[model samples]
Target: MNDSADYCDDFYNYVCGGFVNSTLIPDDKNSVNIFITLNDKVTKQLNTIISRPSQPDEPEIFKLAKSLYKICMDTNAIEEQGVKPLFDYVEQLGGWPVLKKDNEWDESLFNWKENIAQILENKFWVTGFFGFYQTIDIKNNTRRVIGLSDYNAGLARKNLIKGLEDKSVLNYFNYMVNMSVALGAEQEHAEEELKEALEFEIKLTNLTRPDEDYRDQTLAYNPMTLGDLAKRYPYFEWKKYFNYELSPSNISVDNDEIIIVSNPDYFDKLDELIDSTPKKTQANLLIWKEIRSLSGFLNKNIREVNGNYAKIRTGIIKGTPRWMKCTNTVSSTFSIATNALYVREYFKKESKDNVAVMIKNIHNQFIKLLNSTSWLDEETRINAIKKAEKINQFVAYPDELLNNSIINDYHKAFENFEMIGDSYLESSSNLDFFGNKIGWSELREKNVPNMWDSFATRSSTANAFYSSSENSIMLPAGILQGEFFNNELPKYMNYGAIGGVVGHEIMHAFDDQGKQYDADGNVFDWWSNSTNEQYKKKAQCIIDQYGNYTVKEINMNINGINTQGENIADNGGIKAVYLAYNDWSSNNELEKKLPGFNFNSRQMFWVAYANTWCSKSRLESQKLRLIYDNHSPSEFRVNGPLSNIEEFSTDFGCPIGSKMNPEKKCTIW
Candidate 1:
């Protein structure tokens, strides 16, 4: 605590100022926060698991994961190969035009759609020209559908639209040229051709919807058959492309198969861009996307060039350590096995039961708040409470993870996939296809009942998530450690930290985005029209409130529109958890206070909450996050929510008009 600082003026500073001022951001890290600290701990634990030599009786999945890590860590193997693997990959794509002499390249021999379909078939890189994947149909959570949308380019739409004048765009263009030359293209020719390709991407950016348009589910839910898609936008051969793309899974799609096209307007505009652009330039851009995607996996020279671009984007003084990078890669690639290993070795069984109890208490508190909220009409209130009651809470690891049969069945896809001990690039390339095989295998199947396992093998991640499609919240075992929770901690401390996290996820079910989904996770409007209007009116106040606050380091204000969902969750979460704690404490005996603390348990509750967000970040990273991150800066996350809760000011005895106790406060829940 900063004893000299006043709680009323700025509670974040009062609690976290001393720590934030004293801590230095690590050279390799862009920012240091409670979440990052916990993630690093998880990574280190994974390192310990993978670093040990494989036991004779170890599971095949574990052996495979360790092998992947070994290949990544063997820097000598990568350096000696030196761009040959990438050069061979380009040749497999029927050659990049920039790499060819003017007469050596034949335009008639190049078929852009064939190149794209082959890339999609291998699943080496996803975004180029456009993107397609299978996800749960939002309108029908029981089934999955093929989703099509505009290309997620190498650069964001905002940066790409800025043209070469923007430093970020210029850096990207330079990266393309340097990488192409490294792959044996002539420098002057590479630059000239890539410039045209860069312009083509800029045109591509204009075809997509604005970033905010994607927030609403209804705008993106255009369902059509493959036949209809081809008829509507005849420039690309949709049916032929998908038939080849889905061949690996042996699942063929007829023209009548229903597909979800998220950005219908993008396809309408895309036909024009394709007609005006040259096939050669289009080929250059497509192959360049491949080069960009695989650069980090290649030699040190390629990674260093890519690293320079990353330094400009993220503001880190050094790259991540090799072991750390390899550890994370293995964790992602073999998520289920790694998650199983983490739970068996480190997670305590009691934490799950303890956190579940807290979840129930916080859930009941949310129902109470919904019942009392006057802005909601009777029907809206009933529907809101029903949704809250039905929410699926997944605490820690899944029960299925303990079953060896299930783990083995999940990893059976890798049995036939070949991997060389020393050839990291070929191994990585093969893994991409196998990874897509797992994904494409999900097409047209019922949603998995064990939702935690169905997600991107992230049960080992030190983060929590609210999935609106499933109408569920996942509290992975990885996040239930360190400052978040422990079996021995006081209930008040747990409620203030992890308990708040539980409430936050529950609030997401009613936030701007999650509210669109009904209790069954279908995208249906269950609220009364008048109540919906009232909800928006309240939401606007929060938007205006947060938009006014500025980050001094970056001279930028928070994107209130972009971050409103998280802000709503943060504000409502604190209220629910605080009330839940009060109710429990009143029923039980008063908890003992912490040693050396000059405050009661209630005051300590606020302190624990504030300390959870104590962090220091590089200014360059802060600037980028301020523009792109969906949540507010850490300081704002702490101060912004505490200031809105009346109990906080009362506990701290703040003056009514002070910064932490502003007369006009925004509340949505």
Candidate 2:
């Protein structure tokens, strides 16, 4: 935890270890990372808007966001209402057997088929045994396509199959059974029923492919028609199910609707599993998933139950603060509206302009990296440079957030939901209806299928991303503040922090999965076979490098394959930003350092880079992230890249073969 330790040996500690030791994690927070810290700051800013009394001058969407947040904050109202609203919902789905009177479970009302139809009609996105969502077709980004993929079984597939053998898995099982008991079933009956439900989820997980399989877009993209889906997996009533989902909306479909079934084999296996599983068990499983999905919106008891259960799996000792949780829900439900208001206050045009210049600097340096990389042949290098140059940037926020006409259109999309009752559950249901239909009308005009759209995450998010489909890097306003960037700060600091972020996202376009897509965002590999092969060999070095770094508290090694894309991006991004800083510094020729620090500007650049990633995580949070997150821990993020960079070794004057100056280094741009 020494702050003055030689950075060349362990830079993450030299920069962050003391900070981690000094900071106290709030009772409500499981862990605090760079992203979490910044998000909390933004949430506080949003609280000002949410907690304020309604004003006559406020924008229409701003009013909507405030109303939603209030309902989320009204815990007394949520608790007073009790389980009646939830019971009413379950009754509409034909009632849960767990809630039925002893030996009097009615077979007539609990029709699984009718229940599913009603669930679909209500626009409740319940991912039971199957999941359905709309996205731009991977093969054709211009058009939207419906994807009925595998249901997640409420946990990661690996943990789900491992079952009770894993401590976390056992905790989740106890939670499922506890939920059943809370709803008024006999304790023994609840346990027995939920055990069968767990078995059903296990079988579902076994049939599904792991996350690694989806990394390759070529393998992931499986385009087929409705007719083909039926032909391939005859067990599912494809026509009836999809028609039920689409009938309530503007989307129309029949046997000819072009659907993208990502995993045909999983569906085939699922068909067999579904046919063999009992109707009662299927009903129990589906209802349990729905209950799980909606429980948090119910009374305090239900919310606490779900939160406690999630804590076991996530290592989160407590639930997020009620205000923060509500803000997240409201923001996601009405992102465009929330973000439109978000843009006016904390985010402005000036910050966007600064980010634009930084983006250009990073992009130019990235082009050089692409052109100069030795691993890629001439043909591959030229295509890589084209992809890099074509990478468009959406800085701070999208332009539409500032346009009244578009914001009004989006606001009008949910106008009907304005009259939803004061209760949280009531508003949630209305949002389900309003949220589904929000952009559906436009699909008919554009002939676009359901696609990914989120202005809130895009507008105020504390992280940056590169969308392979859009071939663009999005830098949200939330990440624009903090140690990441400041216009008044020295150029060295900005380049090390936000400059690296822009570069990281840009480099994602050439990462393992991203390289599968071309400059046009189409799923086409432009690399020669040899270049592709060589790229893997170099990437393996990173996989090995990161895989060996253990999360000491949990003693879990990094999942390298799952995180390879991010690892590559980290290395490539730092390289890009460093070189970009050198280019900028040489041209501008500015000389300044922090008033008290002894480090030169060149040394400060790397120090700033490490500081941006400083964080403190609890054991539970660390354990969960090791299994779930794509990026390695913040510690390894600093050490891994620097360990492989010769410039770092030279700057720190580390001898050859030192901990930070390995003789062999891995590099890929």
Most TM-score-accurate candidate: 1
lDDT of 1 by residue, 1-669 (tens): 687888889888888899888888888999998899999999999999988888877778888898898899989999998888777777766678998998887777666666632322254432377888887888988887898988788876777899999877898899899888877888999999999999998889888877778778899999999999999988788887787778878788998989899889888888778878998898899888888888888899889988877787789989888899999999988888888888889888998898998898889999999999989899889899999999998888888777778787878877666566587887887787788777887785788544647543767788898989888888998899999987787887888888878888999999999999999889999999999999899889889888898999879899888899999999999899988998999999999987788788898888888888888888878877876789998888888988888999999999899999999999988
lDDT of each: 0.85, 0.78
Off by over 4 Å in 2: 107-114, 117-127, 315-317, 442-457
User: In candidate 2, what are the lDDT values of residues 217-288, reduced to their tens digit?
Assistant: 767577788998889877667787776666667567788887777777787787678778766677678888
lDDT measured at residue 55 in model 2 versus the true structure, 0 to 100: 78
The C-alpha stretches of model 1 lying farther than 4 A from their native spots are 116-127, 185-188, 449-452
TM-score, per-candidate, Cα-based? 0.96, 0.95
Give the best candidate by lDDT: 1
